[model samples]
Target: MDDLDRKLNDAFPGYVVRKDLVKQVRGNAAVPSYVLEFLLGQNCATDDEEQIKLGIERVKDILAKHYVQRAEAGAIRSDIKQTGFQRVIDKVSVVLNEKRDAYEATFENLGISRVLVDSDTVKNNRRLLVSGVWCIADLSYSANEAKDESPYLLQKLKPIQMSRFDFEGYAEKRGNFTMDEWIDVLIRSIGLDPSQMGKRAKLFQLTRLVTYCERNYNLIELGPKGTGKSHVYSEFSPHGILISGGEVTPAKLFVNNSTGRIGLVGYWDCVAFDEFAGKNKRPKADIVDIMKNYMANKSFSRGIEQVTAEASMVFVGNTSHDIAYMINFSDLFEDLPTVYHDPAFIDRLHAYIPGWEMDIIRGDMFSSDFGFIVDYLAEALRHTRALDYSELYRDHFELSDTLSTRDKDGIQKTFSGLMKIIFPNKEVTTEEIAEILEFCLEMRKRVKDSLYRIDETFSRVQFAYRPVDGGSWVNVETLEEIDFPGTYHARDLVPLEGESVDEAVIEVAEDHSGTTVQEVSAERVSVPAIEEKTLFEGHKAYRENQRGVSFDGLFGDYLKGARRIEIIDPYIRSFHQCRNLMELLEVALRYFDYKAPSLEVHLVTGPDDYDVAKQRDYLDQIANAMAPLGLDFTYEIDMSGIIHARHLKIDDSWDILLDRGLDIFQKFDSGNAFAIENRMPEMRRVRQFEVTYLKKD
Candidate 1:
């Protein structure tokens, strides 16, 4: 085990389990992950290898004997009759047999019905009436002479969920792991490899869980399919339920006037709608109206009574059109049903997860490392819902005064949920608080920004915040604003006095391959550009899918007319990293005289610990290759282990700081001779990173 694995084991102890173990024990049992993990938590929670092997066998044996398969239900029934009683794992739902004036249970996959169940069981597990619950059930069969008497009997029943948890212990142990480690642990617990996701993507995945941990929070995610948008609500927790978009009704979601029985909102912590976006589909107006009220006021009207619920609402859907197409011609809410496209409903949403930023679910993304048993994590979150961390940031920072109460509520709920997930101990640094606060603002701002385009009466507000210690305000902008500037700026119906609307409008033509090419006119709207000094110096940021950025465009102006340059980047050890260094050097040579020996470059980098000799060989190859091109290249290892900054100094005139150095391009098919990105770096899709330029005194 690695350091992280050991720390997680020591901190969480028996509550942690290897995530890959679920697959080993899930053979043909069509059960949610939480159900499998509930069993794993009982048998295989320990870290010992022998114990885990034995637990796997024991679990397999239990499943084989108890788990019901529809194909073999008849054989199981025959076995039950032969044995008189048998325990089986299946979905159990209860209903009131009105004529008999008694409650009865039905095993969904076992193909058994009209089994006698006590009223106490129905009262305890009310969810059985809505979507049913996975339970371990005892069934017995007997021959009966009377036609009215049923032959099946339900001997016992137990829901497959965590019965108990220690919230205080969970909060205390959270101190052992840093925020980043905790985030990675949560990511691994969700069956994802943390190393394969970026910081933004990781936070986005964690944001999906906020609905489970917060009350009445509404969220929406619309993007391409296969991104696992609905996976968490469906499989991660027993306290949440996922229903089809078309399957939802006022009776199932809010309240049934006829029975006076509350619906999903009364039982589940979160109610998520799957495949929610379809322009052609029509939803009941009454359902939409009650949902809007419930989402905003946390209450719905049923007949003469008003009912309230704490369930958070989540909508996940697939967009038929890409982001740019929607931004230019329509809006982000384009794929939602006509009823849901209303501005009031859109404004009620606290956040809009940019699902396009997520990569499609791939096989290698699954983790084999140890993480908290999901049931344990689910219980921890459930307990945290009662605690209020919304005001945690008030002492450190303040939001803009122009934000409405609704906006403030949305931001606070999101921030509070993130704090509970990341820092349950309520301890954080100023920068840490700012990171989460800015993310919260951006999420809320995405919803508001779309509202502006959808409804003209919705005036815009600057989503900025100021630190209590007195510093320049930090303003947040949606990534779509930066990527589609022309479309974003053209949304205003009334142009400024000096600017023409024609100039702001840019036409985008998409080809058969779905590649967008923009055609801009000289006449355009004028908006205040973000101050470069505020962004480039001492401020950290991120950019994604940025194009037209090359070595010349990024650093050529700064490095021009310089005799010497110093490059201090610690990660230039691998072959691809060395190739990145060579490309930078070529860019430098293009600026200076190629035949001049005065232009010198020095690299201070860290050596590859696994193979120092190979690192030296690659650096030497770069030096030899550059010497022939009249550029003097020299490299040295930083033995002090303190050279962490990635920056370049050009003759003491400018300092260029880079978050990812020259290795910004994502992994591509470099071996393919026909690949354009292999030959031209400009053709590559760069990973999300940031670069800053600073001028020396």
Candidate 2:
């Protein structure tokens, strides 16, 4: 077992099983992940593989004989009738029957409705009725005449996850376990193995845990699709409901004014809208307005009375365009329905998860070591809602005065959510607090920047906070500067002229390739034919936001006798990655006019991991396509380990050191290929790449 698996085993003792065994015992049973993990937790939450295998076999046998699916519902009913009592696994949802003076059970898969449930079962399992509680139900049919049906069955239900948690007792016993062990217990409780997750990924998982702890926190995620945004909301919790965007109705979401029936908000702990983005898809204005109000105040108006609910709201959507396009042309929230794009509605959101940063969902991302049952974790979160963790950060630092009330709220909510998820026990350091604070600020800034793009009237505020210890204030925007140089404008590069603050405004440029940058000595240098080469004088055009500028226009007019051009980049494999190389060739092709001058383009790149056969196939196709256009492409993998500089040297002179190299375009979209910019090469979308030219030594 891995350290994480061992830790879970040590933490939960015999109650936490490896995540992989849940699937094994599931066999053909169509159940949620939490249900499978619950069973695994009961019988096989152990490190002993032989015992687990045997336990899994037994569990499978029990499920196969008991679980009710659509095809076997009739058989189950027949078995219950003949045997007078039979155990069956099914999703049980309970509703109050006023006339009968008892709660009735609704079996989703069995197609059974209004089955009379025992009073003890109803009263003892009030929480089970709210969300789908997977249970082993004993059905006994009686030949009694009722208004709705001639025969009725008594459902003696047993929930898989009973309310057995002793929160106070657990709090008392929590001191026995070390901090790392407690973290493992939390991980095991959520049915996940910590070993499989990286530090950043663990933080993300913790962020999702806020839904369990906080009440009515509004979270929105917008990015490219298939990032598993809806997975946790749909599959992790019985207390959470995932509704399709089209299926959500005012009657279903809020209280129904007609019959005075409370909706999902009254019952579910979290309500998530799947596929929530699409500009053309029109939504009800009333829905948006009511949601805005509810998200802000945790209450909605139904007739004259205000009905309050604790259900957190989640919005998951896909963006048709890349981030750069959205940043340059429109706001990030532009993909949202026009009705939801209102500033009031946007302001209510606590955090905006940049779904693009989340890696695409793959098989390996799932944990197999151990995690708590998601339902159990969800219930724990629901209980934690009463606790306020937001104030923990105030003692250490102060928020910037420039930030608005909404901005401050966003930051605090995010900080609280993250704290509740990660540092629930309040065992953390100043460094850890700073890390999470930075993340919270970034999430809030995503919302702020996108909103700024939509409405320029909003003033730019400093997303920084000062520590109380008289040290420097932490700035989130400065972190962006560390991550990307293009994040800062050219005018921001003015060198400071003071000896006192020399180190404070120092410029640190790291060139690991051993190429030293000498200050320009233009006064001593004599130019030969440099004045005659005015090719780039008028054609040179550079944009502030452009990732990489094509040098084709700059040196094309002066490339009459150019021969060999060498380009280097460490990473160049994907189609987009290769397009960076192709762009370089596009620049090189400009130098040749008469018979293309037999121009040779040599590319030194790392070895491709995406199938050699496919690479050859793609290159062959490209060669065939570009052969008629007088462009020759040749590439070699670097095995010598000699070259590390990312520069393009033309004929041993006129070198260009590329900061971001040539992979300048933002993520591509196949759906928007018909757009004019996509069709037009020059007008094609490109990201930031810096190029500085110098004469070769």
Candidate 3:
């Protein structure tokens, strides 16, 4: 156990289990994570591995033994009768018997209904009775009930989530850990390896975490499929309810007019609509209008009565097109069905998470570190909704006057949500505040940027905003625009290194036997020149442009005496950033004589602001990739906390600081290895970047 693991264990001794153990016991239950974690919390919370294994086996046995399966419902009923009392797991729903003035539990799969439940159970666990619940219910025979009616009575039951939590204690305990430690704990507790996720990706994810804290907050995210947009709402919290987009109706979401009963909002803390995108899924316009109004006002009218609910709304969907393509050709809401594309409805959204910025779902992305049992975190967030944390940022900075009242509201809501997730204890600094502010603005800007491309009437206001205290206002545009304008501006290459290596050209040739030529390009060369000519025939012309350059030319002379090279880019932290670093190294290797002089590379880059462990993981991945080549590529995290500039250093004396560094390429097509641009180094698309060489004084 690391610092956090020990802390969590010490604080909640005998009640906290390693989060990953829950997943192991869950197997293929198709149940929510909270449900599995609840069982784990009850049985495997202890730190002993053997005890945990035994507990997991016991839980599995319990589920397999008593859980009602639709395929074997008849067998389960027999067991309940034969055993007299059976503990069964199933989706439990309840209905109020207004005529009898009592509540009855209904087991869906077991085909049992009206199992008399005590009033205390219904009143105390209203959440379980309100929505679907996975529970362990004690069954007993009740002969008084008719044969057609439920004969088995629900004697005792436990809801999956521990309803009661110490919110104040949770908040107080949060003060003990630093922001980084807290982030690590949160990531680990949720069973994720924080080391694998990137800072930007983590920030994007934490934005969603805010829903766990705030009430009536509306957020929407539309991007390519399989990004795990629905995962959090579906499994991260028991308080949240995830519904299929098409399956939900106004009655289920808002209020059921037939019974005058409030809908999901009255019960769930967070309600998410899954699979919300597509051009053909025709959602009722009236429903969208009602949702827009309810999202803004936190109230809805059902029949003659007006009802208010505190549920935060989340919409997740898949986009048919890439972000760049949509931004250039259509609007941000292009994936939204035409009926739901009204600007008024879109404007109701508080933030638009850049779904395109998220990586595709992969197994390696899951974290196994310690985080709050999500149900506990959800309970904490339910209380946090009442506490205002947005003012912390306002104390240091102010928003622009040009931002409309509605726009400011959107920004502040997002800011508040982030504040609650990252600094729930209210312990943060100016720099941290700035990062959250920048993120808030960027999220809102994603909405605005897409709007501009979609509707001609939408004004092309600067997707820009200013901070109060001191610093330049930033445009929420891609980094390519700021650093590699000459190249990304046109979204194409300008051939700055025309024909040869633009300014520092490297040339390679192959002999009849097809071996790499060792002679350097004559247009530009170091202090020394190569004398070989026989190896110069059948040479192919290539250019070292900003985006993706051919590695063959850069490493043609590695067989010489260049043994140690230093990479000094400032942006090698994220997975994509690491990929860029790997590409550069691959190019540098072409010059090495594999049989004789082996090459070694070293990297020094900036530390990630969101999480440091992820930075370390990226470096390790790079090292692993070069291990086979006998290349020793290592990285040391920059401690200066002020290196924003991107650059490169070779050996020790030769410094090649890049204006754009490695993250100069535009997003690739399909992100596949076999893509033409990905396979052909020279053809790979890249943004324009300036490389300047300096010698040691």
**Top TM-score model:** 1
- Model 3 alpha-carbon drift over 4 Å, by segment: 1-4, 11-15, 145-149, 460-475, 478-697
- Candidate 3 weakest lDDT stretch, 10 residues: 485-494
Top-lDDT structure, candidate number: 1
Q: Write the per-residue lDDT of candidate 3 for residues 1-697, one digit (tens) a residue.
A: 7777778776766556677676677765667777777777777777677988898998898778876778888888887787777888888999888877778888888888878888888777777656777788889875663554577877788877775778667767778787777776676666566665545556777888777787788889887888888988888887788888644778778877898877888988888989888888888766777788898788999877778888899989988886445533355687887777877777678888867666677677676545566667777777788877879877787776656666677778888888887787788888888777877876776565445434545543444455665677565554322322222222111224455444432222232234643543233223545656332222222111233354343333422345788766667888778877777777666666677556778777888878889889878978988888878888888879676776555556455556666665544553786788677765554443444555555
Write model 2 residue lDDT over 1-697, tens digit each, in one string: 7665565556556556676776677777888877777777677767787888887887888888888978988887787778787777888888877777767778888878888777788677665566557888877777765576525475467887635765554344455555555655565455555544434445555666677578888888887877777878877776777887734778878977887878888877788899999889888888888888999899999899998999888888999987545543355687888888877788788788766555566565556666655655566666677788777777787877878888888888778877766565666677767777877887787777555545545545678877867677676752223323332211112334663322323222222233532331212122355455443321122322233234454345434566777778766666666655665566566556646437766677665665656655555665565556666667777756566677666777567676656655444343486865444444443443455667656
Using TM-score as the measure, name the better of candidate 1 and candidate 3: 1
TM-score of 2: 0.69
The per-model lDDT (C-alpha) reads: 0.84, 0.66, 0.70
Q: Cα miss at 443, model 2 (Å)?
A: 0.9
lDDT of 3: 0.70
Cα error, candidate 1, residue 460 (Å)? 0.5
Scored against the true structure, residue 591 in model 3 reaches a CA lDDT of: 60
Error of 2 at 518 (Å): 27
Candidate 1: tens digits of C-alpha lDDT, residues 1-697: 6788889998888899999999999999999999898889889998899999999888888999999999999999999889899999999888777899988778889898778888888878877777789999888888888776568788889998877788888888899988899999999998898987767778999999999899988999999999999999999998899997644889988888998878889989999999999999899899998988899999999898887889999999999987777776678898999999999999999999988767788787899999989999999899988888978899999998878887888899999999999999987888999999998999999898888788877766778899878788788877787766666634543444787756454533342234664545434334557765332344444465444456766677666677999999999989888988988888898888645556899999997979889999999999998887778899899877888889888897788889887778765566688987777775555667777778788
